[model samples]
Target: MTDASALRTAILTSVPADPFQTTAPEPRFVYVPRTHVRALDPDNMLVVGARGTGKSFWWQALLSDAARATLQIPSMSRGKLQVGAGWSENTEPDKDTLAGLRRAGADPRQIWRAVLLAQFDSGVDSMDSWKDRVDWVANHPEAVAKLIRSYDDAADADDTRHLLLFDALDRTADEWTERRALLKGLLQLVLDLRSTKAIRAKVFVRPDMIQDPEVLAFVDSSKVVGSRIELTWPRHELYGLLWQYMGNAFQGAATFRRRHSGWKKDETGLFRMPDTLRTNEQVQRDVFAEIAGKAMGTNERRGLPFTWIPTHLADASSIVTPRSFLAALRTAADETNHDSELALDWRSIHSGVRRASEIRVIELGEDFPWTKPAMAALEGLNVPCSRKDLVSRWTANSVMERLDGLPTGDRNKNATLGQQGLLNDLVEVGVLEVRSDGRYNIPDVYRVGFGLKRRGGVRPVT
Candidate 1:
């Protein structure tokens, strides 16, 4: 029976203590339902979710296990698509070489040819020349019609489960247009695979990236084919995931013990353990109550349940990772360890969660200018407005249009763009929603943020 403190130190030293374990780490956690790694079958699913919702954790977990089975970088261009400018003799002759050539006024077609050659060489050893590779696909259209097709055939024939996980596509520094193009192109490629039935693509995208017409186009095809899965976690499920991960990191050292063992066994697992003589369930309920109290004063926020304590705790470490929960806990542990205490702090955890949310909001805002205005307009209207109605009334365009017909103070594009961009920022921040029929609506979660009034006012309440 090792003490909790001694166990914590041993576990800390035993584990690498990295929350964002982009590389690898030992797995000790149970497969909580929320974070359960799904079997990679022939299904194209686009998984979209907010920050700290177990997107990356499950992604990495699948990737690590399915390494031999998954075709990670299926791009024919291999690594060339990621590289940008620069050339130094002392520097690496990376994929950026092609980007450098393009920058030096090289023909785009020629650069593409070289990249195609590189890809063929690395991906298809059977191919000899770039022309031959291109001709092979052209001559045998069905044989090599699309990148995903070839991979699919190979995967299906072997009964292999290939999980194509695309994470951080939004984080790419490519220009807005380029980013949109790349995603649309990749999605189009994925769309090509449905005809073959070989691999499954799961993309973890923030809501903003999915809102673009071009980006949305890709998913449309998949959705029409009925091959998309939205990533959402109930509060309880989310809490369960966090608890499972943390419990694993702590292993069975008395500090973190399980209530139940095997299905046929009588051992209690972590959920059955007692904290300060209180059962695990009781302790969890108490902790959640405390956290919810801090998040929303005892008044009880709208969407969040009054007894809301999801088994998992949301934090940045979970969001930025392939990292294990223990690793994230360790990172937080390191911060708290500075105070010579081996305990996790609620304040620090709460702050980490807030910081994670803020970063996501900022990123979404920058990428999607249309997001804010859409949200603000929805907020101001206090009710769903038709797409045309919103654009005609709530937007700066609407504002200008109203003022312009007055023969004084006409709408200005620059001012309108500035104002509209700000409003769009709100939408991107997940505070608003643009409905299918062109209407704009707010999520129930953010309804409180908008203080609505039915009274008539000359100026719209933004």
Candidate 2:
């Protein structure tokens, strides 16, 4: 086979089938972005990001010693930290039981304390139900405090730190008010633990959750909010991640490693990104051109593949997530013709964008169920349109009425939003954009998925 075909095979096999499937990412798959090093610090209590970013991925990654070593964070590289999930997508029993405890009039703060106490003291774990544990914790604050102190004392002696990670807080309750209250209690618990030297709580939260005024309304709330780090994947970092995966693949590892002097294998035999690849755009573009050609097509007007791929895949806020970027390239590799000179064909890259959009829309529905139906109301409607025109479409389709019927936690808020409020909600999530001329536009990543039309947009695959 030719070099292009061999490279295409390498990419298709190396890229993961599901980039968002972070329940147990292998150590080889962990690519650390330079900007995310601060986010991995145990001192940062809150880490926020939009869906498809690496919030859950990092949550799971931190739990693995191999993955933690790949991160190379000074505090975590030693592997001396004790990490446990206080709450996460996988901790369903804890969520359901905590919801029950809340209904039983148990204080959310006490409930969370019980969660921590159970981790350190087996007796707390012996309790059969959440209520029983919460009751025990509430009735015995001194005992709970003593247990935490003893644990911290041990960690201090060992020169180690204990971390409790919280993710998927939105799944804690069905009602927004209840979820907000529960989150507030968790944040307060994080603050309460701040005084302890060896015990810390890190919360991986959605941006919208922490941004709500009601959620952070507490004494010293800024202490948590002020130190929060956003999990973002800049353009160069996205390309860096791509190279990491490609460079580590068994079939093309030698070829890819030789192409760039900066790429190196670590002690674990996984590829580590160089500073130049992470920060230098021209270097990344040069490396990308080797596989996909100098430009997207024969001329510059068609756009450079290095820039076009990310530009089209970006959300309204101009954020291109690692998940979407990887997914698009993987699909492009799969669709590229075997006889083609490029590893990823320009036409296949466009196909990759469509696949990425479909995946993004599905993820949006999973995170915010109301988005699909709400966006569906504007199907076939051309973007860069006036707010009045957009509202007319929603009004004609009874979009508000349809949204009210959904079982989302934000149903009440969405129903009360009316047409104007709904538009703002979409804009806030990076699904829709408002132009400087007061027109509404949907980014290609979402526009194609929602079946919306644009005068010169990438068309959706029929």
Candidate 3:
């Protein structure tokens, strides 16, 4: 198994510190689901899952014409999709700028339409101000539509399609109150984009924003919601992602490929993997069995390795993100030892789980800064604890008393102050897991992140 050591070397060399920032190359992009491929057909929009759900990765990947071509979604093959940004890091003006237009007596919906128009007609940029752009759009609604249509007609004439992408709107405003108007206006604009067949827009919305009742209050929410796809990883898919990476890593290493030769005995003596892996049952069984053997624990009471890793790493929603999965794999590989039963020894895998939990904690802290302080209060408190003890822990750390000081940052714009309500909030975000007995436990994904240890779990290094 010297080649396995080489495989381990390749994995360690490839593991990125921030998995979200890393993009799997075209040949390596096997995690995408066919639903995502269909949703990518310009007209269908998907509200990506909470952070780390491949929202940003897709945004960057689809930006490359080469990547779009690999999509193999027949609709996109005409030519490279002409991508425009309704909201992106490089193009969008800040919240203050949008607020400036709002202050100028500009209707937010109209301003959003103006932004859409600007994407089609670069001439809108020559105008002195956003107000000027707004006025121009106000004066020529048909012209705006006609301009967008013209671009589509040109693309069609050239045998291609045009698509507009919207992502990272959460960056537009810090507070939900400030962000709501911006999103509501943009959502209306997206809903309206449906009328046009040539130019389609893909809006990557956050789940909480779109799911919020107030945000859905007045609009024909169904139209926008209907086009939405949520980013989620099933138990098997998470494992598939692991083998997909290893398979790709194999392609890069000629020596490793020469050594293992091929796992498929009947096929040519060379490794072969698809550009993307969906639910290929054979591939999952062979690749993972090679890495972690068949069973997870001594007598199969602990389940299979393919099942155990993803199951333990899942958040409250039972979703295992690629980020967490990879983190766990990298850690397991790093910690494997002589006494280990499998290539990825079951015992050694816990350290990976532990590290993934820590990274997840930090990421959650970044996503919800206020919740960080609140989560820290219960750091050492073991789970399966009663709500009374939970509240008592918060009270002990003065987190309950400082509820007023905790930043009420929320996706739905509703932050809780009451103890039980706050605990429920933690559960909603996958920070805490609730049990049938009304007791709560923190999943290992978040247990270490929040600095909490289970009653009989691993101790923190301090």
Candidate 4:
């Protein structure tokens, strides 16, 4: 028992306390300034941004916070269901809850059908349910009528603000058609449900995933795209997070000192952290400079300071998501933890970026099997390929055909689907960028990995 107690203490001692722990009981660092405070308002909002930008954290946080407040929007639970992440409609509590509600006069089938339509359609369906739902919602006047009636009944019961937090609609790993169907269904449902002053649903989504031509046609596109709070960890914020993370990691150490130490004595004797942990300016300088350095290589001169780091080297217009940030940080931390000197070294961080780059390449390579071929072709030409030329020559080709024809003998039928999946996966993962002109390009940091030139253009690579 004594030994067990000692072990537990040691384990607890190693655990780091978070510095940016949300003051409002429920906190999500992603979407910090925007969603944290404003989300609780009665107005229904569409929190749009890039994936990993802290949408889920904020959405869940707000929901949890709402639980503690005066607001009452029916006692419905927030369900975490993303396609491929879980069986959306098959879960027991959800299915049972909806069934129970339906038995109690709620249109469980209709409400659920709308929820599924709003969340899951992504174009690649060979399934009848997908088509049926799309057609039912789009073609039938009855479907909309039924939804409005359901909303009206709920409103009559004083259950007006039915906040459905569609957190991960963009996280679905579905085909384009299914993706399109889901997006279109969401807009249709939104328009139909808006008639009821009582029913309001907030969709937290990634902008890139919603760019389907079909969905865009009906959507106020600008409402989502324009007001989207791009999840970016600017220098100051990123630095603060890093500092807080490290301070927590080193908490309880003899060298650990809080800012308020000796504050009661002398004003000049304020206890700031040691230099080993990053300051606000140092983190910004280091992150940007490191990103820039990776692209510049040994030359060490040229490129935007923001572009210098691998994390932001993809597109200035592109926003970094929380998942990507976590990936980069975990890699950097693993490397930092292993080094004899426990410090956040830029070289170690860059090495972490390279590791992330490799994973990014492999992920993109799988979906758009043409990814590797395109890179190889770029390497052969030693010049940037035009967007038109790339799509026709590579993106249009099947993964098997692309790999079977490669000169490197890296072709594998077993891995062909994996390769094709990579392209779509990378785009979903935000490693590759699809340009407005329909061209695909890799980040400049990744260009070095692929042995290609550093040129700025929107393009795809996984």
Candidate 5:
């Protein structure tokens, strides 16, 4: 086929099939954003991000030497750190055991300490049940502290460190109260461990969880929150990530890399984006223009494709997650005509945004079940409307009642705040926006997926 056809085929294959399904991302796919270096530091215990961000990806990445090496963090480069999952999306401790321990009056702090200790000490791990382990930890506080200190000392002597990672803490408990208590306990444990020289804990938490007052109620909690780093993918970094994938693709690596002279491979043989490409928008735009063309259309009025792709995909908060960004391009590649001169057609890019929106809605539902019904209540309602109209739509559809009637665990705690509260909740999560004029507006990313309309915005795909 022609060069453009071959390039489009390469892009379709290069981009991940599902960026959010990153339980075990391949090593070559680990493209670290420059801004995220702080989050990789062992010192930063709390790393926060919204859904579809790289929390789970980084959690899995850090465990693999190949992935960690790509991060180039001094602490992790030596391979001297022993890393273990204290809790993860897939590797959580038994829920029934935790429930039994909580019911028996075991402090959440003690429960988590037992969990951490079990990762190192065979004696702690040998306990047949969580009850026995937690009970042992509670009764032997001094002994537990002493054992942890011994591990710390050993790590220090070896010039290494031990890291315990926690992710998906939302699944730790069904009830909001129980989940908060468990999280508070884990945060408390994180604080206590910070004093150790060679042991550290990294928690990849959702923004809502970390910001909750009840969860951060412990002493010196601000220290953790104050030092927390957000996992974000800025515009340049998003484009940089795309190039990383294209530059590393098995088929079009040479052709794609030739478009940007700054791209180079690291010691691990993976392509590394230059510092300029990572920070310079013009440089990024120039490189991207080679594949997608200069403008989204025959003229510039339709907007530059470099900016248009992300603008349409951004949430109300103006945050464009890497998952959505990549998803859009992948769909764009798939929809582009094979006979087209450009690798990606501008019209197909719009289709990409639609697909990305659908994907975002699905992800939101997985994290917050209430979102689907709440948005369903507003379907077909034109946005940039007054708050009264928004509330009326919800009331008419009995949205609040529907959300409250959801199963005990599925109910969003925010739903208890009534209609206005639900609006605030949506605004907080970047699904809805309250404009300066007090009108409610939904960002295009969510607007299309939820079947809402805007007077002059991109139409939702049928």
Candidate 6:
């Protein structure tokens, strides 16, 4: 038999190296639709999404002329856009400043305005005493406006637009209640900023940020919720992403060559890429079929590669992430490569599925430390169970006993949510799903993460 392992290796390596850290669209950057572009508007002020769906990628792209151009957002040509004058959870100074202000009881709106002053007012203070400097700028909007106007005049343009982007709201405060207050105040500030035409703010947040009762207390957030963009990946889009990655993978296949040749000769693909980047149906089917063959394995019973992978990767809320999807492909290749196979075998794909589940669990543990600890209590217990069965596992494992100071991935820190309350909290975060039948079933994505197995689902937890 001819050696085809190298071909398989090349095919695997052709996809993106790291889907999460994808810096450019070369190997793969999914196109953000015009509707999504409108939703991403800095003027829209609030963006809601889960862990994936390009929240971080979109936020980072806006900072780069190269990245912005690739997205083909209509707003880019609208004006001279100046990025991110406001605040982000990524910056140390911004995080510390907000934390300090919250520690000192400063209003979130005031703190946000102060952050904006750093960009608008050149002479604005950039020191640790950010509160006093921000307060000073707050008392003097004319100077900032003058600074803004002068730039508009110098550019010979009608106006200079400033965008304030906020992301990673979870990092704002480790203490649950304090974090909620900080987010609430920041939301109010965003709503208030709508009055200012030239200056705008965009917030990228996890879907559950607004779930706290106190955060919504007395605040009319209808406008904010309406603007929410749930970062959901559709079935076709997921397949489209697979094809897009393969098409860019620099593979020697005629199919990949044909698609990549277009991108190589056309400089426009890198910037202001066409709307039909990867939506070609024939190309998607041909490329995917070339890699995995017709079915996931020998028989149709094993499930098709395009459908089976995404269906298994999705969480309880039916949300699938690019991260998990890519992870499975890479893992499948890693597990079964160098075997005497033309492509990933059915057994290997399922193995990849398990590996992806495990990696996702570790990721969750990092983000929500309480994720494993709380869920581990149900290691041997199967799910889709009654409320009593769920509580029995928690009590048996002494879950509440170990929750003190554990991070729940949201407010209400200190494991203050008793057993039942913890279950409800998990449901809200997509960790646990409450069914219409009132029975609680854990999603497969998280089942392995928590080491919880279903009756007929994943293999027995080792």
lDDT of 5 by residue, 1-462 (tens): 666776777677678887667556667767788788889888789999887788888898988777777777775665388788888656646666677788899999999998899988649999988888989999998999899999899889998888899988887876767888999999999999989998899999888887779999999998878989999888988987887777777676777666667777678888876788778999888877767887877788889899898998888889888889989999988999989998888888888899999989888887778888888888888888888888888889888888888886676657667887888888888888878888888888999998888886778855
- Using lDDT as the yardstick, the better of models 4 and 5 is 5
Model 6 whole-model lDDT (C-alpha atoms): 0.65
Q: How would you encode candidate 1's per-residue C-alpha lDDT over 1-462 as one tens digit per residue?
A: 333344344345544444434443234443334222332222535666564445555555554543212222243112111111111112222334423433445432232223332333234336664444434444454444455455546656775544445566554323455445545654564554345654445566665566666665644564522445545544444344444444445443234433223212112232322223222445555443332233322344522321221212222112232222333344434444434232444433333333333333343335443333433444445445554555554555454344344322112213346445434544545454566775555432233233332232111212
Give a tens-digit lDDT track for model 3, residues 1-462: 455565665566555545656443554444456446665666576556777667777777677665554555776766656876677655656567776777777766778778876776558866887779987877788887777777667766776666777788777776766567777777777777777656677878767677666666556867787768777766556655555456556433444334344433113222344433336656666666766777765667767777777877788878777788888888887888734545577766778878777777777876666576677788777777888888887778877556657545442123444677778778878777879998988787887667777764544424
Ranking by TM-score: 2, 5, 3, 6, 4, 1
- Candidate order (lDDT): 5, 2, 3, 6, 4, 1
Assess each prediction's global lDDT (C-alpha) against the native.
0.40, 0.83, 0.68, 0.42, 0.83, 0.65
Off by over 4 Å in 6: 1-11, 14-30, 33-35, 92-94, 125-128, 138-159, 218-220, 250-265, 269-287, 296-298, 339-341, 366-369, 384-386, 404-417, 434-439, 455-462
Q: Which candidate, 1 or 2, would have the higher lDDT against the true structure?
A: 2
Question: After aligning candidate 1 to the native by TM-score, how far in Å is the CA of 437 from where it should be?
Answer: 26
For residue 3, give model 3's deviation from the true position in Å: 2.1
Better-scoring candidate (lDDT), 1 or 4:
4
What TM-score, to 2 decimals, does candidate 2 have? 0.95
State the lDDT of candidate 6 residue by residue for 204-262, as single tens digits: 88776676667766466666666666666776676656545554455533344443334
Looking at model 5, residue 198 earns an lDDT score of: 88
Candidate 3: lDDT of 299?
A: 69
Supply the TM-score for candidate 1: 0.53
How many residue pairs of model 3 clash at the backbone? 1
Q: Report how far off residue 417 is in candidate 2 (Å).
A: 4.3
For residues 1-462, could you state the per-residue lDDT of candidate 2 as single tens digits?
Answer: 676776777677678877667566777868888788889899888999888888888889888777776776786755378888888867734667777888789887888898888787649888887778889999998888888888888888898888998888878887777888999989999989988989999999888888789988899999989989999888888988887777777576666666678766679878776788768899888888888987766787889999999999999899898888989999999899889998998888888999999989998887677777688888888888988888888788887888888776756344575777788788878888888998888899998888888886688645
State how far residue 157 of model 4 sits from its true place (Å): 7.5
lDDT of 4: 0.42
